[model samples]
Target: MPSSTPLHTPFCDLLGCRYPILQAGMGGVARAELVVAVAGAGGFGCLGMVRESPDLIRQQVDQVRALTSNPFAVNLIPSATDPDLFRAELDECVRLRIPVLMFFWDVVADAVARAKDAGCLVIHQVGSVEHAKRAEAAGADMIIAQGVEAGGHVHGMVSSLVLLPQVVDAVSIPVVGSGGFASGRSLVAALALGAHGIHCGTAFLATKESFAHDVHKQKILSATECDTIHTDAFAINWPPHSNVRVLKTEVTESIESQPYGHLPDKIPRRVVAEEQGRPIYWMSTDSPLKSMTGDLEKLAMYAGQVTGQITQIEDVQTVIHRIVAEAEATLQQLSNRS
Candidate 1:
């Protein structure tokens, strides 16, 4: 049951959302429908635009605007893709007048300034306290402290429990705690740790509106905390040492059997099962997209340790309400105990 009283925090006020929960801008999976559903449900939604073209981004942005009038964000991994293409996407985001833009992996000061000048709020996701401070200095409106427990290309080695407080203490800007957050209990815990909000990826990936394949969502639902393994096997196609937390599969087993230097330079396009004529990249780091259809088990099925807590796929509204309601109850119980 949802609490009679709404849970309000600084993060809610800052993002103008009914709750402080943020659906992560997971590349390849966070699409327009997911973003609109989350935004419409009073939680902040972020569109993962890292792998999208400028034209697709424009279409998605327009689609989101048509669905909801609420504020939403677009996430870009500036350092992960081609520079010219990234610049084009950035220009499109500014041209579309996006309310918020999030950058992960590395921060570009000049690009940050340009987005700010265009009236877009900039949020940077970092893994360390030093990076949080650097984001603050670079004029970020907020920072997402991504811990080692996060799925897909994690940034640092610290756990969220330890990293959140360190980041909160380091920067004046509002800090969002990411990695392994799945439910209201964790949301309340993050708030207790001084985080302004929580950013959830693996949990959201299992939602009905997510673009992830059905098998992918079921994999998360059936997984336990111990089922996920962190390794750099998928990072061979991306930057070296870019570790990922994913469900252990035969593909991972095969990768583990070989020496790091023996891995293939690129995963052939034919190995991916996707829509006919759709452009598929050679990177093993790419998640299974909705358009993908073949060899689903062989692709990267990214998830977090929190997958153990997700038993079923629910609509975005139900997920948000349940978290808010549960957090409210927990907070009240704690208050009474004191």
Candidate 2:
């Protein structure tokens, strides 16, 4: 059944989910387990397939389908992915008849058109009102207006409190607020801002089903809202100039004192760890995953400013249900006001 009272919004109708909450497809953290749990719990789940090979995308897509018939999305980063690989990903997704493709970083018009042509609903996560308008112009079915305080690749500098409403007013499509949102209060705040939903990365990253390494999860649990630092120091593998908001580590402390510019993109990548036999490079945007082993600090420990609100770990279903119950209670309280 669908949600009610500020929990259900147009985003639910667009994605065919019971609630408008979306688990952001954070690379490495979002996998089949988390996606299935989220979808089964009546919220949207997206596979974090950023810059991955098409074969892996297919396998993960199949894995999610095997668990549930619910609608989910595969997230891809266009501006950061290799052109050839990006095209191949789109082709494979189209061939598989993927229900939705959630894109971030930039709104690639041609790629979005290709997905649309295949009858796939397109979602683009943007940082600014300009990009939101461009995504709308490009026929994106929904827009996740991400703020600078978000974990991982941050494209906009403004906080969601100011950015979400700006985006909601700028676009005709239903908008979802991203960055610094975790609890039911945050959902009510987003609704008040005219947003239809919330895209949560850090909150889901701490869930039991999340594929993040235990060490990384602990760090997030130990962090506060002020503990996250936004910087471009981890853009070695992807395109330069893209920024990420990660937990303050020994590395980020030094980077925070300097300018937020990218290291030379062509610099040699030092392998700091291995996950499922794949080399995890130093200064890469790859979040620590469960299969990862090595110097975990070398990789980005992505988290959002909402870390202050997250204290313990829970399963995906419990987190969603609690948030919904809280949102209902909050709505009732607000309704009783003068």
Candidate 3:
């Protein structure tokens, strides 16, 4: 259903953007093509910076820059990233004068100040009221309240529907609602709850330009809302531990059944597990390469709780356009009812 009310807000104003929809900075799965596609379509595209080295970050920044001149943000994992590597990447952003810098994991005041000093709009991703408060205190221009329904790693266990309004009520700064949002109806709900914008991940993950493999996209299209499970299985074996929201498959089920801290034993420790000789799950990297390779049934397929709501893989432009149009229509209808 489309929103009947015309949706317009401030977060969409500063950047001179047409829509308040934000393409989530999905770690592991976020790529240059996907970010550029969303940004070109009038939404903010974000590059996930977790696990990316300075060189890789530079290459990605160059790639995104080459694709589109539109504004985009880089998602930074503060804790996991090495201080020097992080600083170098930060310097690169300062040099490029990136439009936005979205920080996750933990917001350090010094780093926040540096980004601000460089003139980048800083948006911090948080899960709870406390985290929101801290981010705001640290000088975050915006806060992304990511609920448990969010895919990839999450900081809070609260659902977006519940967490968004609470955080909006508690904080004076702009709050962008995230988690389980894959459509305009979700966008309307976020704005109604006082959020300045909606951050979508799962919906974008199934797009044509997404880095997600074909098998994984099929799984996302076939999934139901009840198919998702948050597990620390991948985190247990990887460094810079992070949680994951994945579809409940055989591999995920086996890991979930085991007690915490025993992931390696439960799943056969493959030093060099590969799909067609290309290493997928490398013990050295904490990244979710398993999903990147064509192995959805055995590897992790991270998706939001709204996975079941998705039924097909569509073009990125079409997906973004539909969300904005539907959101506007839905908002219009709601306004008429009142």
Candidate 4:
């Protein structure tokens, strides 16, 4: 898998992947299995280890290393993790010599510098151009301009159609577009938006290797573009004023739903589910992991607007292969017309 394809861009060399597709290191979904599958298939992946223990991080890194030599990333959210725990997780990645350290939420400048000092490439996902500039000033190697149409926890109000090119122009580093991207046509559109690569969450969440529950995958398959809702109903464990996009459900439409972007921390929280004995509180910043049990429909079902584009559950290899082939075809069509 060399960068000889028509879809290859400068970001391909930065990620050391054949295609300019990077699996979104979605917390609770993009685990070791999915990361390896994507990397082995010529796309880059990031392990979603946000708020995870140091021991678990080491175990996952070991698993990925044993399975594939392709460089992968470990995702961490400083805004969601405890200070001490964040330090420990950062230390673990640095100690393991992880190739890439991907971050979300408010950019932690010192953490970025430390990871870079440890010889790790730092990718900071930002929602606004000012923050993108801040990340670059903090020594981030790349930036992911996440639009409001993204799944899970959304960071910005603008759509990819508007925010992506602005962020690319605002920063000198390679910019990757996130949100509302799930197909080869979207990938070509991302390139047209001046993004060097595409970072996808909803697309990979439905893949066979994803850690998402079967119910979650099925919902995406059956959903449409209009089925996504962006609200702050699931902001228990994260920062206040957190905006998240999830599949529309009874929970979201119920009378108990919080006022948009305004959920009181004092709201009653019940343990609605568990993953490997870890409790998942209601309205927490987590979706149903594959290992989760109990009544999960009462919990969050994070999905992007792109969920509408997914119809079937494919393996990571097939997903990447199809996207690349389709992107190539799209490029040829444009060339023919010109």
- Candidate with the greatest lDDT versus the true structure: 4
Cα misplacement distance, residue 26 of candidate 3 (Å): 1.3
Worst lDDT run of 10 residues, candidate 4, spans 255-264
Q: Give a tens-digit lDDT track for model 2, residues 20-127.
A: 899998986899999999999989999999888999999999999999999889998888888999999889988888899999887889989999999999999999
Ranking by lDDT: 4, 2, 1, 3
Q: What order do candidates take by TM-score, descending?
A: 4, 2, 1, 3
- Stretches of candidate 3 off by over 4 Å are 1-5, 236-241, 258-269, 272-279, 282-297
Please give the distance, in angstroms, between residue 210's alpha carbon in candidate 3 and its true position after superposition.
0.8
Report lDDT (Cα) of residue 126, candidate 2.
Answer: 96
- The TM-scores of all predictions, comma-separated, are 0.93, 0.97, 0.88, 0.97
lDDT of 3: 0.77
Q: lDDT: which is higher, 1 or 4? A: 4
Q: Rate the local accuracy (lDDT) of all candidates.
A: 0.84, 0.89, 0.77, 0.90
Cα-based lDDT at residue 240, candidate 2: 78
Summarize candidate 3's per-residue lDDT along 5-101 as a digit string, tens digits: 3565777775546678888887666788898898888888898766566676778889999988888898876666777877887887788777899
Better of 1 and 3 by TM-score: 1
- Candidate 1 off by > 4 Å: 1-6, 257-270, 279-283
Which clashing pairs does model 4 show? none
